[model samples]
Target: MKQTRKPPLAVVQISRAVTVIRFHVCLLFVFFASTILATLPSNVLFTSTAGSAVRMPINIIANQSFGYFTKPPQSDQIGLYVRDGDGRISDAMITPQSKYQNFLGVSRRQRTQGPEYAMIARLVGSWTDCNRGAESCVEDGFRLSAFEIKTPSPMPTICGDALITSETPTKWAYRDLVDYQYIVVAMAHVKVDCDSGVFAPDIQTRADGGE
Candidate 1:
């Protein structure tokens, strides 16, 4: 009988090396993909008191104003607002409140009577419709349940001019310098959903902080 010939040792070694390289490349891709998803807005299913699951929209405000101002000037007071699609501003309330409220209070105290400082925040909330024939009607009302805040560097264009100027005091509107919503949609490489009014981020750009 004829003896079977074996492949060269060098060729086998090269094949093993190639397989190992492919495995590592796959692992790297998975790691990066997961990282990006973590940074992007996740669709968290939040249940309302009525036992219905509601998907709240997570909005990124690149540069806006926040304050803890009240009539009595309480040390633990905080308030934030965001503009909705209808051009109406709504309250963006934070949960587990005291910690964040105190932070804002301290921040305000440190810069008392100075220019309003800018902030970047990611807010997760839902909008509630106003009741018909109510005593007071607020259009396009939103209530935020969760939020993350960061101080912006190289503030946005709208922030350049102080919200409250000596010439025209009593202004406390929160505005953005750029079209942040548009920017976020573009960065995510996703188009705006006209029906849902949501900007969905793609997997690759999800992890980016968008700073």
Candidate 2:
């Protein structure tokens, strides 16, 4: 019987090297693919209808009692600087206009007088990185496509339910005028000019009012 010949050691070694090279090439392809995806823009258009459920809860209230107000109907964007109970601040944007004008109206009233209000709302949008040289984009923040306020009804009783007067019987505390848990603030239509690293709005007002 003829003896069977084994493959040469050099050939076997070459085969192993080729397998290792193939594995590394596959790894490199995946790494580059993921990097490219990470850099792609993720701006989502706001399309939430009225009464829609809140999807992503930001769990925050406006840091400033005043200054942030609801945008007018003609404006296309709403800018906010919101903070959680712990006081962690973040930049938020409400875009494409306010679909829930009723809520915005309520907020406008409460905000104009100067009262910090909490919100229970859904933030439907993408959280993108700050622009290259944006001064106000202090931290990576949310570019809200939709904001839906969901303040619980039959307001909490911790605060006096009746509108309490501070200065006079006819004068009511601005904070007591509305349900703090469900009021709106900083819902204005403002352009986010991160390219210039400025927070300049086309219009400015002393009295204020989002989701």
Candidate 3:
């Protein structure tokens, strides 16, 4: 007796169907996971870029605290300075009209409109804008304080967690994360000028990112 063989077309079609099903199953799994993550609290979802289980609920408390302590908003000129871990300092002049001032109430100085002013504004805004403001100064918009931004070092943190060391060596701690590259200390110093008008030294400490 002769045995019957399966058709080549049938075999090929079956194989293709299996592969397609697998691909779709994987896609669905990923989609469902991402949706669950989106529903979770920011702190929990943010714990690990990929992990699903979270311990803390994400909240705006930290940001709210910053806004509370920062000086009240006002209109004026702003000075920005940046110092790298290498100790190099760069400066930018900003006023209520400059397009690139990142902090609140900063923009092109009204009388000093020019390409340089535009360039400086762009640079400072790109670095940080914790103070909050739109690009380029607009009507009724207050300017950032020059004293708040003119320094190379970050603003000092008088409170919050402190950095300490121990005589006996111990495992690195999550608390020690304050030294993480992205974490920075910044100080805002504001000054009023009759010529340049009011400005602030906004100090920023940038993240090294270990790159």
Candidate 4:
């Protein structure tokens, strides 16, 4: 009987390379598949509640709009206020306070105040706890400069029109110049769905410490 011939070195090497390539292709496919799942209803973003209550004063940055890495921070980032007895949080678009009405395109259409947030928030973010000033100051249970403050009622945390699920990440997320807490992902002005209406704020005093 004739002996079987062995495969050449080049053939073996080529086969190994093909195996490696296939492995990489499968890995990429898995990653993209997971990202697609994140976009679906399954993966929610900013779903967890923050529990740090550190007071930090913040200053509003520029009125101009700047892009983050590849995407933009949420301009006029409508925050989710504190949770209520019902375990709900309210999410509303920033009221279009038209100090720069012309910039906002349409005039003040929100209500008594301008828009809840600016069309584009560059570096400027005021404290939510301000009494009467361009800036506001707010104190809460969360100590971090920034926390996902839940609304008093249940509302959607949206990016553009679609809701942000837990899987959604801070892509090209921008932070306030003075404080890291005021971070946002800017999405140009778009129609918003305020579930109910803005909830009454929880009365809380500012922490005496924290510069």
Candidate 5:
């Protein structure tokens, strides 16, 4: 076979120019794509699980004290905080519109509308409005995010059993979970703004998840 000859210098130059053009085109495309992404509405919904158990066994005292303080929560269960929340609220209707001016989130100066921190309770079932403006007559809600032990297999405990076991940590905790519910045993400082909120994950709340 005859030996192959190299392309002419002009041909090589043209080839190099074509390659440079293609590279620039690609770079421009990436730049445009990134710019578009930045312009689009960004959703910052945060979700996470600590992969721990909630095992605070309550004695059968019918909500009666065991005459002794419950043991301090385990290391994994304590000092939980919601991450990434500035904990600011604005232009929201807070109940107890009374001395409510003194509420944490309410601005004493502004009185009604101010940077407020709200306590949002999650109810078990569909919540309905109560008559006579009764705030206490609403559906059963939780102050703390009730959590049960996370298990690989279905762990069943007696519904009638007043004693909380490692399997079922709460008196009635068999309901499906929802957003912002802390599944671990730790205490989390939930962070949010007036618009929306999420639990800042990977951080616990000794310092309100760094507030």
Candidate 6:
């Protein structure tokens, strides 16, 4: 006697539906986060009811002289990198608010103030807690292709700046300045889909933090 096998059409359909639902959920999360992120304070970048939060160890440098140095730090220091949905790297320093806006191009028509920039800014402010003034503040003069990853998040932690030195001889280069300091901020954004995603087909601003 031969046994007959039946097709799992119902199971297949159910699986497909589940996949679609998951994709939608992810899409919704990304969209909501991106929109609210731009308007939110850096302190509260990832506090959602969904119970997903990423704690990044922002490098806090205190009471350091500000100037252009020819040598890298003797000891390891704090640095960051910014990336977009396409994984393209930007070698911009976001320590100062002006640099953040100008180098990252947060204002005007040519700026790449994507998720990474917003995240970095928020983190820098929170790390420094710069309420009174620029004194005893935090600034990221060092350049990093990536960070040390002391702790990892379930979701990708979008860095506002890259913190590795392999890519560039110098992570940060100071112009003819002798008494300037700034706090570093960083962030990143990943697209759900390019062909049918809402955030896709978007253009990043092209400002080098220079007016």
Note the Cα lDDT for every prediction shown.
0.29, 0.32, 0.33, 0.33, 0.28, 0.35
What's the lDDT for residue 193 in model 1?
Answer: 20
Between the candidate structures 5 and 6, which one is better when assessed by lDDT?
6
Q: Which candidate number would show the highest lDDT if scored against the true structure?
A: 6
Report clash pairs, candidate 5: 77-186, 79-205, 80-188, 80-205, 81-189, 81-205, 82-200, 83-200, 105-116, 105-117
Sorted by TM-score (best first), the order is 1, 4, 5, 2, 3, 6
Q: Rank candidates by lDDT, best first.
A: 6, 3, 4, 2, 1, 5
In candidate 5, stretches whose alpha carbon ends up further than 4 angstroms from where it belongs are: 43-211
Model 6, C-alpha of 180: deviation from truth (Å): 50
TM-score to true structure, per model: 0.22, 0.21, 0.19, 0.22, 0.21, 0.18
Model 6 misplacement above 4 A: 1-7, 42-211
**Model 4, span 32-146: residue lDDT tens:** 5644333333224522132112101111221111223225333333442333345343433344454464356465344422122322122123333322111122122122233
Which of candidates 1 and 3 reaches a greater lDDT?
3
On the 0 to 100 scale, the lDDT of residue 20 in model 4 is 100
Residue ranges of candidate 2 with Cα displaced over 4 Å: 1-3, 43-211
Encode model 5's per-residue lDDT on 1-211: one tens digit a residue: 9999999999999999999999999998876564433333324532112211211121121223422455444311211122123432221233333555546545444332211211121211122222211112111111223322111112111111011101112222433543222233212122222221233222222211111
* lDDT score for residue 194 of model 6: 23
- The TM-score of candidate 6 is 0.18
163-207 per-residue lDDT for model 6 (tens digits): 321111122454234233333232212211222223322333422
